[model samples]
Target: MILFKAALATGVLTVGLSASQAAYAAPLSASIQSAATDPRANVKIDSKIQVERTEESASGEITTTLLDPATIKVIPGDKLLFTNAYRNTGGSAVTGFVVNNPVHPAVALTEVLEDWALVSVDGGKSFGKLSDLSVSETASESAPTSRPAQASDVTHIRWVLASPIAPGASGELQFRGIVR
Candidate 1:
């Protein structure tokens, strides 16, 4: 899978997910991408691939284990966790730091672990809480109609820092998904 980073007109760095990436993903391991050229931020992203299973133990307890891409196979119903950890490597505190990650089409985002994060259903033009977002359904009736945005309708996930990120300070943003 190829993780893409693009600088947009607004100066926000966007991490795009290749739509075909899931087709090549066997076990679905994610990488931490670096913006070495940015010179102000150092955010490492890691997406953990895990699946819940019931082991044949005496207690019959269910467990979730990490899956190795080289060994275990990722299939439908498998849960995914996308994590982004960031630290301000600049000399001073940095504000207006934003990271946008476009969800892969093969995955359905189930939850947003970070309350500060925003979601975009219509590409990345607008972002807000999932409850405040909507999408047009044109294939249903004569004209286009609006419908509440579901987790599956989310196309892009974004994290905007409300406060400045101090030098050497670090935090994480994460979301959960299921293989579609």
Candidate 2:
């Protein structure tokens, strides 16, 4: 399956292999723009994907390798890191800023900063802790007949700035997932 994961400084959107692929194409561009929108707030957002690897030095020291996004060819079981940087270029403070990133459908979320963001398992409609979210296993089931969410169930990740981002200030948010 070919899965696409996209992250916006404001929010994350993801697309999975399904019959409704056409419905997902239009909102992608709009969502990216919306994530970076601040009106008077001038914040620049940039993102890149990296593949993770581990190496051991002659001294037995362990180090991590973050391959450049341009050079990596993702495959199943490979870990991918998505990074987003937001810089406030405006002359004033930007408040109520939020960032969202979508997890790839074929990949599952492994680690996340729980204190920094909320996760959604239902296509970005609602978000919360994985333990607090549930998904219906039966199409005909009604009235809370659902199962607890798992890492593979995640659809989007979102972070809301708790404080105003001052001019000339910059911040970043990152998330990791394994390719299915």
Candidate 3:
């Protein structure tokens, strides 16, 4: 595992990040970005990039590894974990902090384990739980209709922080995706 980690640590990576309705236009690198001020609440946003590695031993046990996306080659079927880390850098508490991540075109969103997480299929125009959302499908040759949205159609992922972020407090929102 250690050797694998080392071998995969020499490539470039780009993680998309955004907060609230304020769209962060640039992609992030391996190291943490300098503290960024959220226009709505004065919070700072950071991101973590880790690749999922599952290994099985002869005894039938499994272990996972982290691949530095920046250093190694990411191919199809590789599951990558994208994290949007936030901090309340302002002097006062912040309410309704929203962390959003736009799903990359080459990746298919798999899991959003956070309770507050939501996904959008219309290119980030709207977001809702997969169970509550729907997409248009054709039931007949005459017209197209709507249907329950699936994880595979997700274009963006979001999380609504349940509680206020106290002054100097921090948290992270994450989602999983598979390279396609």
Candidate 4:
């Protein structure tokens, strides 16, 4: 009986020690082999579009006009003008450039796009998405009649340097609009 109890007690003590050790045991960790190895390793190739801007006198003129961004103020039905100018400073001819504008954050673009054209609205983010307003003429109201940016009094203007801006070349795009 004594031997049996001794053996049983040893077994119980071993089990208790193992249970306590297991309670405070370190956790098992597993690593996934196919997990994300690099954060940006799968990134695709990068593309770039070169751009430039400039402006000059119209015809038979030798005067340099000091051009700069204009500050405009008007009511909901008033008109606003935004002019963008650029120059070709590259030796190679360039074509197919794009220009874009968003409703000036300070000026509530949402109000400008409200019904009745009462508010001066222009640019990609103001009235429509940039993708939907592709093409130069599409921006004009004459195209689909969905309030074209071109004919909609064009409260805004952007000049995209399409043609190659021959080295030292200059160009300017001006816009004029009337409020409702």
TM-score of each: 0.71, 0.72, 0.73, 0.29
Candidate 4: how many backbone clashes? 9
Q: Report the Cα lDDT for candidate 3.
A: 0.64
Q: Quick one: ranking by TM-score, best first?
A: 3, 2, 1, 4
Each candidate: RMSD: 7.9, 7.9, 10.0, 29.8
- Candidate 1 Cα deviation (angstroms), residue 144: 2.7
Positional deviation of residue 108's Cα in model 4 after best superposition, in angstroms: 11
How many backbone clashes does every candidate have? 0, 8, 4, 9
Instruction: Give a tens-digit lDDT track for model 2, residues 154-173.
Output: 88988777888898999877
Q: Which scores better on TM-score, 1 or 2?
A: 2
Cα lDDT tens digits for candidate 3, 1-180: 000000111123223322321122124332222334432346666666577889999999999998666545556778878777778777777766566666767678888879667778997788787899989888899998998888878888777777878888887777788877
Q: Please identify model 4 stretches exceeding 4 Å from their true place.
A: 1-79, 103-162, 178-180
Give one digit per residue, the lDDT tens place, for model 1 in 71-168: 44556666766666666666667666766777767678899898778999988889899999888889757778888999999888887777877877
Which RMSD does model 4 reach against the true structure?
29.8
Over 4 Å off, model 3:
1-41, 58-60, 138-141
Model number with the top TM-score? 3
Q: lDDT tens digits, residues 1-180, model 4?
A: 000000011121121234343232112121212214421111111111111122456665564332211111222333333333344344444344333332233222222221222222343334343223433435456655353333443333233333444545544333333323
